[model samples]
Target: MSAAPKGNGARAARTRGPVHVIGAGLLGASVGLGLRERGIDVTLEDLSPTTVALAADYGAGRVRTAADPAPAIVIVATPPDVAADAVERALTSFPSAVVTDVTSVKLAPLLELTRRGVDLTNYVGSHPMAGRERGGAIMARADLFVARPWVICRDEATPAEALTLVEGVALDLGGVLIEMTPEEHDRSVGLVSHLPQVVSSLLAARLVPATEQAIGLAGGGLRDTTRIAASDPELWMQILGANREPVVELLDAFGADIAAFADALRDPAQTGAKRRIADLLAAGNRGVGRIPGKHGSSERFTTITVLIDDTPGQLGLLLTELGELGINMEDLRLEHSPGAQIGFAEIAVLPEVAERAITDLVERGWRTL
Candidate 1:
């Protein structure tokens, strides 16, 4: 979960208590809330007085005061642009604290801080690989970081206790700890996170002038590809700008793939064009297969779309029936039936068992689409 704790004293000290979260937005509030859930003392601060109050009101923690004791760790969850400033302030304000930040882009802020000659001793750059499409204290969830990777960037000079303190809090919040240099973290996220955001947003932008009929015909494929496009544009702009080097490199590579794919499809008559298209598409198939869980390669399983009423309890009843049938569903995806009071449950099962599942469902009065 995305909840929290802190550390003080020895560098290797396990998280002690009283985590001061700077920036009471989604990540900060979620950290406070998660820590508070574990009965850890947390203090909240933000540029917006109202935002901090809202977070505190939601039981994240009390609003910070000048009289409060120094925090063992300060989590700077501000936007990437101002992250260095916040981290610098935190390090100066709480000299004894092991300061960490959850900003997306890792290297820029680190460089900025180094440029300012801030002592690198107490500052540890970190980023939690977790977030929601929409962000705010209202969207904060205690379990946001559960099973997600929390990357800690430690230099050779980083003390064992400082690393332990940051890692301990990450563990307390159910994050899987990953150690990386700042450069590695930035490049990895550029490929996996930032590049995709740009692609999805551009793809969704194409639908803006489409006719209602054309748009209404969109299906799961479109939805899956464009879902992240709904993310906060302002936030993404800041992130993309901060990580421009890696993200731009990634976008260029990805754009080349798109151009190649489009050129092949434009005219099927060219020699080797069909094969090029197939190879590119097959590459996508192989890539998708590498992804974890429900969207595994179609070669691994056969999906049967069962039609059913969209009313409450109906989906649960289907799942209950599935268990009763002795059928094991490897994965499942759901889609709505537009303008109809029904939904489609696309259940993936081993090819060997798909026929029996569909037959059994049909026998139990379910329709398949």
Candidate 2:
């Protein structure tokens, strides 16, 4: 297990009593598992008894009992549809506790609570930007939030002690903390997270009526673009609905961009048509370049593709050889043809070592592309 970061911020807000997690789903279970790793007491609850039991079985935490004292922290990890209700209940149920949530949309729940005239002093909103396409207690992992951004939505009225407690839990679970208001957080995610999910789903939906021949020509670009389209639609419906205003605004802007690109592509003979297309494409390159690398920095690497047999041990042997060569791989991806006996292993390495790594692999009888 990894050690929780030691510092005044983290130390000041150490968990005093059992940390109660409502909704034993992926995020809840992951929180429990991570805290348990740090020897903190965690108690779990869920609408479904089976889910709570399963998470407990997976080492997340045990079910809460009536005899247990009021918790020091309450993490509501329910679905977005019921997130506001859960947060309200948590705040009322544990009046002295610092209540926080892992809901995707921040504004809706906060507004809902305000509409209900619920006291919000003890509540803080948070979103851990880490999840699998698939979710549930079965998919929970202690290190799920490691190196991931965890946004904390705090208002001026929010107490410092409450904020500190929430940040401590996030840091203890290996998340990089970011502070943002509910409005700022919602608008930001509408562009980065929600927009991508919608675009990916729309792109993948096109494949439904595609000819087999056309589908067979798919490559890494198609896979990378549509990967998140496999996410649960029912879950997305709640998220999209909760953050409807911002997402709709984003969709309108993106649609206009798409229309502009289509117009340019359809009339290449027009003045600056080709230039418009190139500029749009170049803008995409710049946007991608801004995405942070492994530890929140913009660094680029070179990728080398090696051809290998489809046999089970072939890929393992190739990786073993690379280790022996003392070459560190930054990333690895595999691509295979449907009926082919060979596949490609794309290995990312530092740009300075790419040539030497390629030469070594080629000398070891590996073919490169």
Candidate 3:
């Protein structure tokens, strides 16, 4: 339900009490930091007292003692298997607050909430569509959700006030709002999110018994392909199980593509069939175009790498120098090889800005490679 007409294309202001974040993991901690940065009083809670204290120490937000009163906006960010249960507890723990969950699997949790007779009026389902391979609150960032799509699953019984609060939360976190039915959210994620997990794991699994010489030949392409394999398996098992149906459908489609490629490899005289292989690769190129451009614009980018010494103020000094040079970076990645004292910082910039950045960094006594 839409709020009453108000400002110039802005979400309704937060009218609830302090936002309470549960789980104290990466997503939970990031949410707390983002909310507090927006001037919203945020409190973090976790099942383990020590983890909760650690999150508080990392500035996720003030940790709530067990005896403290419940907060108004309760965000459940636990694993998918326990998200519904956590949501139920949160709703019951704070009856007046608008409740939401940050679980990836939406339909299963929504159905569970409905079946368990949990109040639906003050609750809605949300997935921020962002995460990292690393875990824990120490890795949290306030800008983590910036420009990312935040999926909101709407239902008939979802209260207008609850939607307002959810939208406010996303907006304050710098996330773009996208509304979808729970079924739609599940299907879309299965194609984009779950399918990639399966593919990355399959690729990574092949390297288990490889020789040292073969592993030493690994390049950025293989690194890119298998990066997501480092994700926590326990969390993925719950996600895959929760969205099994949709993910299975996508895997079947992927299997067909793989089969076609296999047939192309075996055929020696089929010219037309070989062209099909080329077309398949071209299709991937086209698909990349469909993804949103950086910062919501149509701009594209290329990445450049700079080697920086691993020492205090090195990263900060590099960033400060880049600012002085007025070079805008699109994206950046830090990489360090085993037993190496220096780290490679991969920075993405607009193609037009690449040469200027390289020249500026070299002039500032920074290595381009």
| Top lDDT model | 2
Candidate 3, after superposition: displacement of residue 291 in Å? Answer: 1.7
> Each model's TM-score?
0.81, 0.84, 0.84
Return the top candidate by TM-score: 2
Which pairs in model 1 have colliding backbones?
A: 3-34, 4-34, 4-35, 6-16, 11-161, 12-161
- Kindly indicate the candidate among 1 and 2 with the higher TM-score: 2
Alpha-carbon lDDT of model 3: 0.83
Number of clashing residue pairs in every model? Answer: 6, 0, 0
Cα lDDT over the full model 1: 0.87
Q: Which pairs, if any, clash in model 2?
A: none
| Candidate 1 worst ten-residue window by lDDT | 1-10
How high is the CA lDDT of each candidate model? 0.87, 0.90, 0.83
Query: Candidate 3, which segments miss by more than 4 Å at Cα?
Result: 1-16, 66-70, 294-304, 307-343, 347-357, 365-369
**What tens digits encode model 1's per-residue C-alpha lDDT throughout 1-369?**
233343221133246778999999999999887777666789999999999999999888899998999999889999888999999999999999999999998899999998999997998888898888888899886656766789999999999888888888887777889999989999999988998899999999999999999998898799889989999999999999999999989989998988988988998898899999899889988987886654533545799999879876888999999999999887788778678898889999888998999999999999997
Q: Weakest 10 consecutive residues, lDDT, candidate 3?
A: 4-13
For candidate 1, the clash count comes to 6
Q: Candidate 3 at 147: error in angstroms? A: 0.7
Ranking by TM-score: 2, 3, 1
Clashes of 3: 0
Q: For candidate 1, what's the RMSD?
A: 6.5
